[model samples]
Target: MTQWVFDLGNSRMKCAPLQEDGRLGDVRALGYGDDVAGALDGAIPAAVTGEAASAVLASVASPARTAAAVDWLTRRFGCISIVRTQPTLAGVRIAYADPARLGVDRFLALLAAHARGTRAWLVVGVGTAVTIDLLDAQGRHHGGRIAPSPRLMREALQQAAAQLPAHGGDYLEFAADTRDALASGCEGAALGLIERSLAQAEQRLGERPALLLHGGGAGELASHLDHAMLAPSLVLEGVALWARLGADG
Candidate 1:
């Protein structure tokens, strides 16, 4: 039977089939709008729901939205596994005193990063909010930092000041126009944080950790950083790994 992984975030839901080779197949995404069920029904292919498949989900959406998604998946798949943040799993250990307090999405991303190799890593997620996580060469998490993403910054500014827009503009060292200035300032803030985190991680680990960027807004920031690996399907990859490890255990 086929196994599927779903990553439900604050803004969107991403799903993909876990292939026979233990890799993820094509990923599909749907944004959450007024009608959650309708969006899912319209975006997911009929073939996926028609067959006998199992599903694993890691959701950071609201309770109401998560309940709706669980209800829908329950009707479509024979088995459903919802991912939760664990203190220790598959070698990677969580640094949070309360494991449940750490977001599952962040945990899953750490899993995917640590699975890559023993090299130290700085896993960054740029979605609704920016998350920066540090993983040592031994898969030990060293806590993380969260900040508003550039998009969220713009949106918040737009809300507070009607003159600014929530989108558009380009990142520049010194923007001449208000739109470009807004983009530059917000994106520059995120970049500065990531760079600072990288330096701090290097100091703590005594070696430069490899940078891994993931999430919807990652592309915007990838070009600014050197040797940054952009893995948009990272969370889903972690879900697949989580499922595989569970099945093995």
Candidate 2:
């Protein structure tokens, strides 16, 4: 029996068939602005959904947007399950007293990290925003920090300062032009935050934790951090894990 998992983020919807063994097959990504109805069209094959045993989702999008996507899924798949941030799951305990306040994506990412190993981890998600969470070998969350992504930083600069441009730039050691400067400065800020977090994590954990990077914007910053391992489908992986565990039930 096949299962479907959808990871609905701020900018895109990443969907894939969750294999019986818990691996994803043939991932499909769709970008959406304000709504996801159109993007889901024909993305999943009808035959696949017809024979599917279950469907699940992990979303960090707005409530209205989530409702729309859930509505669509229900219409096509009969029933759909959703993953939510919990205070504790699969031996992992969240730092938040109010787990619901924590983003579902972050919580799922933590679950995915813990499931992969018992080692200490610094899970960094670079997307609409950059989020860094520390997970110890014992499945304890040491809290996390969130900051504007390089793209968001550039957009903010352009929006507030009339002359700065948000697009068309490349990272450089020493920027020779305004575009390069903006790119470097914004990207540099993200890198600086991660580096500082790494140092702090080491001090707190008594050893440097393995870094796991995910999200669309991760590629731009991952090159700067040699230790980061890119896990592009982390959230979906978490969604699949949660579905398989019957936690979404």
Candidate 3:
């Protein structure tokens, strides 16, 4: 039975404790904060039985943000945290330049999708930022692009301009009131950004890759996303895949 899984995401810090018989599990989201190592050092032990699997595979948006978390994991596990640098973990080989520069989360999602044996995919992670990564039918990660998250754009609009009042989401329709309107508009903006990116990807790839969306805000945008299949845990699945692969290697 797999033990524990941890993901220090772009926004919140989350961990899950798996059962002995492989019956799925419960995830705990430790609220976000400034100190990655300090926050994670404190949270990781209490969540996992300390003796649980020390191998933590993390995906970080910022290299610096990931470093501190890796440092903390090192102290506890005595095993260096394996920061995912592309070129595949399970079956997804990153074919982008400076392969290590790819986001660990995105690669892991691609890895997880590949393990499920999908021939191709447009792995989209929606959180503080929305990234659209592509993998060809041959299970190779082509590359990806990043854009301001719909929420961040909305917040930026509201914060920079007083009247907007900071709103964001996946609502496709216009709303009746001011706040709701801002929210809906934000969603519209996100939709447009993703739609165009997907369109371009489809054009280049010659088909609609299986669309997978993961991250904190994925729930809000998943339904409205033109994507037929969506799972918030793609990253976790990838993490799980990464762990299994590491064990095998």
Candidate 4:
């Protein structure tokens, strides 16, 4: 039977065919829209051919969107499972007092980072929000912080200040125009948070933590980070690992 793993975030849906050797193959990404449903319909069949298959999902979307997507997948794939944020998974313990309150994407990303056997990590996810979670050598979460991503910051400024444009211009050291100023300010805020977190992690842990950057906005922010490693598919990778464990059990 073919196994499929999906990561459904607020802005995008990513899915892949899980190979027998536990690697993802020909991953497909679709932005949120009516076309997403149609794309999945064709993509799944093409991935698995005519074999029996099941789908595993990790989602952080609204209830309406999740329900619609699950309903569609159930009709097409027959067996479907949705993974939740547990207190602990794959040896990584969540720092949240109420673990369920934590985003599963963050939890999954931590799992992926721990799986890499890194000494310690500062997993930074830059999407609708910038989330920084610290994981220690022993796979224990040391809490995290969340801030508005650069895109959200820009949008907020545009909404709150009529003079500011929501989209335009490159990030400049000192911008002369409204557009570049907005970009610089927003992006700088994100970078500042990450930089602060890195310092705090080192101070508290007594060693520097390796940075793992992921999510759609990571590329833009990564250019400013000296040691950040791009790990765009971490959540999806974690979803696949979760599926594997479930299959074994």
Best TM-score among the predictions, by candidate number: 1
Q: Which stretches of candidate 2 lie over 4 Å from their true place?
A: 51-53
lDDT of 3 by residue, 40-65 (tens): 76666644434434555575736787
User: 1-249 in candidate 4: lDDT tens per residue?
Assistant: 877889988888889989998777778887876555675776666546332778888889888778877877787675888888888777888989999899999998998999989589999999999999999999999999999999998889889987889887788889998888889989999999999999999999999999999999999989999988998899998888888878432
Please report, as a residue range, the 10-residue window in candidate 2 with the lowest summed lDDT.
45-54
* Runs of candidate 4 exceeding 4 Å displacement: 34-36, 46-51, 247-249
Error of 1 at 81 (Å): 0.7
Worst 10 residues of 1 by lDDT: 43-52
lDDT of each prediction vs. the true structure? 0.91, 0.89, 0.69, 0.87
What's the TM-score of each model vs. the native? 0.96, 0.96, 0.81, 0.94
User: Candidate 2 residues 131-203, lDDT tens each?
Assistant: 9999999999999999999999988998999799989788998999999999999999999999999999999
Lowest summed lDDT window (length 10), candidate 4: 42-51
TM-score of 3: 0.81
Ranking by lDDT: 1, 2, 4, 3
* Candidates 2 and 3, the one with greater TM-score: 2
RMSD from true fold, candidate 4: 1.8
